[model samples]
Target: MAAPLDLDQLQTFIAIADTGSFTRAADEVFRTQSAVSMQMRRLEERVGKQLFEKEGRTNRLTEDGERLLAYARRMMRLNREALSALDDNRLEGSIRIGTPDDYADRFLPEIMARFSRSNPRVELSVLCEPTVNLVELIRRGQLDIAIVTHDDEKSPSEVVRREPLLWVTSANHMVHEEQVLPLAVGRPTCLWRQATLDALDRVEREHRILFTSWSATVIIASVLAGLAVAVLPECALRPGMRVLTESEGFPPLPDGRIGILRGHSSQPEIVEALARHIAESLDNISLPAPEDTASFDFAAMNLAVRGRRHKPGQMAGW
Candidate 1:
């Protein structure tokens, strides 16, 4: 029978996969670069598969490495669950977390499942609100932690994920080609709204906000119905939507940033654990480009979104 793989080595492998660098993985796992190299060498020999290859400056996972990554994550997760289940001092309490509805559908499932499995006794309470409201709630001690849209100058947070913010319209509609583009956007405080308007202004494109709502569902509905074009992170893209590009006259936009904010709560340990889980889940999910549009320039936005339009000041439900 084959011997079991080393969890320590698996942990290092995961770190390297997440960081995309042997050096950064060493720092993350609290090991020296040379030690990290040795661990990978041993792991390669044990598995008899070359796991990583150099891609310019960063290390890219080999095909076999990608296959191993799935197993490695599951093993480490199960290990944590087993330890937690048997530990006498396992955490047992309720923790409140807030995120915009835009992310709730795509992000919450993995995060909730991971946290619940490892800390079965802990109850998770989720709140769906705009990033601005969530930031305020965290500040007022109403929430233990919040997943928010990062704005360094406004709602400062520890950015956990980033993806391309793109222009989207109904797949069957040419709403983007209208002389005065009609838009469905968030309220005045929504960062995406400003960014959209600014991008149009920079290109001297005339636009009008035909549908205004903070709700991602509402904006998505409008876009799908061919009522208007909208700006959204890559994850929020739905099947019926087509991405707009510079050739179509849409200017480039900044990447959408998602962040974590810790509240002044008493459950520091629980809060921190959830934060780590959130970060891990985000790291594992890659950004997917729209498949319907051959001309969609995902490379321009740099890849990534969850499937909802989250803007500052807009409630997820509108």
Candidate 2:
């Protein structure tokens, strides 16, 4: 009989697939690179197929690996659910999570859904705010955990991922061609806003803020309506937006680092659980391709806008 697949190995496989790098996968799974490699070798031997192909310095999933990825995710999800169901000491506590509006839309639902399934008794109070404010809230013990963008590598928070900051504009609008560039910006405390201003200043590019709001929905709307261009994290680039490259007369903005900050260390178990879920969920979010020109759904955008407008302080909750 074939050797049975191990859930641990399958989990590592999913991590490798999500991160696209064995080194990053090792970091995510808390294993050494050699150990991860050995596990993959053992897994492939058990399956009787090579699962990965070398592509430059990165590992690309082979046909067998691609087929196994879906099964691995499903199995892992079930495994987690089974474990949670079997645990006697179910986690119960109120967790205050703060995140930027843009990230809230993309990552909050999955994190909350998974966390809710695992800890049904837990109540989550989510706050959507700028990273600067989130940091302050976490410091003041108003928030149990917060995900923020950091430009420094030496920050005390746990770095989740690093992505480029892009100049975003409406696909149908030629806002970049204007004499004085119109901009949709976040508050002054926002890192994206500061970075956008700094980059433009360095290039001596003339620009004016046409719209300013803490709500990402408003910023996105301004861009979508062809009212202004905005600087945003690459992951926040929706379907209707076009990314302005450095070659297109836009200076390169600094990369944005997404990290998690913990408030009080009292609820270590609950905080750690939520943090792990956030990190894993973030890993699974696929970024838009640079050349993708897909038309965004206006219905979804309108809903998001309304959601942001009504609940300015809160992005999502369960």
Best by lDDT: 1
Q: What is the Å distance of residue 121 in model 2 from its true position? A: 1.2
lDDT of 2 by residue, 45-121 (tens): 88899998989988888989987986787688778867986798878878899998888997788889988988888
Highest-scoring model, TM-score: 1
Residue-level lDDT for 134 in candidate 2: 80
What residue runs in model 1 are displaced by over 4 Å at the alpha carbon? Answer: 17-35, 53-67, 286-318
Cα lDDT, all candidates: 0.83, 0.77
| TM-score for candidate 1, residues paired by index | 0.84
Q: Residue 20's C-alpha lDDT in candidate 2?
A: 77
TM-score of each: 0.84, 0.76
Cα-based RMSD of candidate 1 = 5.3
| Residue 141 C-alpha lDDT in model 2 | 84
lDDT of 1 by residue, 1-318 (tens): 999999999999988887889999999999999999999999999999999999999998899998899789878877887898788899989999999898897789989988898898999999999888888898889999998888878777887777678899887888888999999999888899989999999999999989998789899999999999999987787777777877778888887888888998788999988988887677566445445545444454332223332212221111
